[model samples]
Target: MRRVLTALLLTSLLPLIAQAQSYSHTPPGHTGLGGMIGNPSGLSLKVYGTDPASFTAYDFLLAYDLDRFFFFSLHGLYERPLPDSPLNYFLGPGALLGVREGSSHANEMVLGLSANLGINFFTERFEVFLQVTPRLHLIPETEGDIGGGIGLRYYFGSQ
Candidate 1:
């Protein structure tokens, strides 16, 4: 009787185990649209990373800065996830472009190099993330700044 009951229980659990094995990670070929509020706060978008080709993901941010000027950044990130966890961390190189609030001889348009570092938590079709950006101003001036923000994204499409 015990052996028969054990066999039946195991058989019944097989489908659940199969479903768990078929789980997909966040993003990963999916696109996420979201917003962030920080130093330069506005729109955010991401082309989540894929596997077997490259571990790189593309992220974009378009926002207005504390100076009331429009700012945009793009990062090509290398992402990794914690073992058996829903948390992911990414780091990568980025480019920054911004327009000055007013026309000036110096840096009417600013260009720079920035680094993107962040952690993400995912649920069903949503992701919550936090990032810190360290930047180097290379055009119009030589300066450095650090910025960070927290954001939520909703992923769509097949992953």
Candidate 2:
């Protein structure tokens, strides 16, 4: 009698274990905060005769991938993303309010608006993404620019 009862209990538990393992393979809704390090490209003045120059800008972003197709990111970016594909992919519209200090420019507050788009890849807990943002600066000078970078994000939630 003892052996029969033990065997029945083991058989009942096996199905529950199998179901849990199957669910583990699917990804859950994830969001994260991360930082990125990349050079800023597409810094150009719109004036016909103005000379073109470039700056190395860094950015820190807070991102929420609402779903696979829709995402929202708030960036503390120094510059903007460029408009192009393949090489300069990931462009979206965004805004920035920060201070700038360069070799020739004084320490001043900057207000900028930008647009961007990008791609994202994810595992259960790790996420990698790349994006580009085209921006227009309102302070110091009114100009058009582009910036692109890659980032890594770690998800936090029930896995």
Candidate 3:
């Protein structure tokens, strides 16, 4: 009986998946702008590779650390589309530079290396994404930590 129910559920969803229309979220050479909310959350920008067939991208971000400090990051990412869905997964490594604020700690710069993993949901002209990043501090000290955020981007080109 359990097997029959499982099969029925899958069968019902198969037609929906097959009939779905998918639009490319970020085609090559297109740029996206948006913002995020979470650890070091702020303005976000991304540009897909210039090659039409390439799945690579560049990401730039300016974010704040919960009112404590501001940071900037630039990453090289590769996006993979999930078959039969309007979802994409991306991962990459990047560098981060942050400046502390408030009190004598202000104006201190910290450098780190970051690895990011994220998923994106594409609509006709907008993309929503959530990402988690692990950072390893190298300068000013050595420490490892993880952070994540939710963000949305608007595409400014053809789908």
TM-score of each: 0.76, 0.49, 0.79
Q: Tell me, by lDDT, which candidate is best.
A: 3
| lDDT comparing candidate 1 with the true structure | 0.76
Mind giving the per-residue lDDT tens digits that candidate 1 earns over 52-150?
A: 477567899998867656779999988777677656788999999997665553446789999999877666666667789998978778989888777
| Local distance difference test, candidate 3 | 0.78
Q: Count backbone overlaps in model 3.
A: 0
Cα distance off (Å), candidate 3, residue 97: 1.1
Ranking according to TM-score, highest score first: 3, 1, 2
- Using TM-score as the measure, the top candidate is 3
Ten contiguous residues with the weakest lDDT in model 3: 13-22
* Model 3 lDDT tens row, 88-142: 8899999999886747665777899998899886666777777898988787789
lDDT of each: 0.76, 0.43, 0.78
Per-residue error for 135 in candidate 1, Å, reads: 0.9
Q: Which wins on TM-score, candidate 2 or candidate 3?
A: 3
lDDT of 2 by residue, 1-159 (tens): 533653565466445433432211113233354554343411211101112242212234432221111122233322222333212222334576655564565566557777656654445554445566766778778977665555555656666
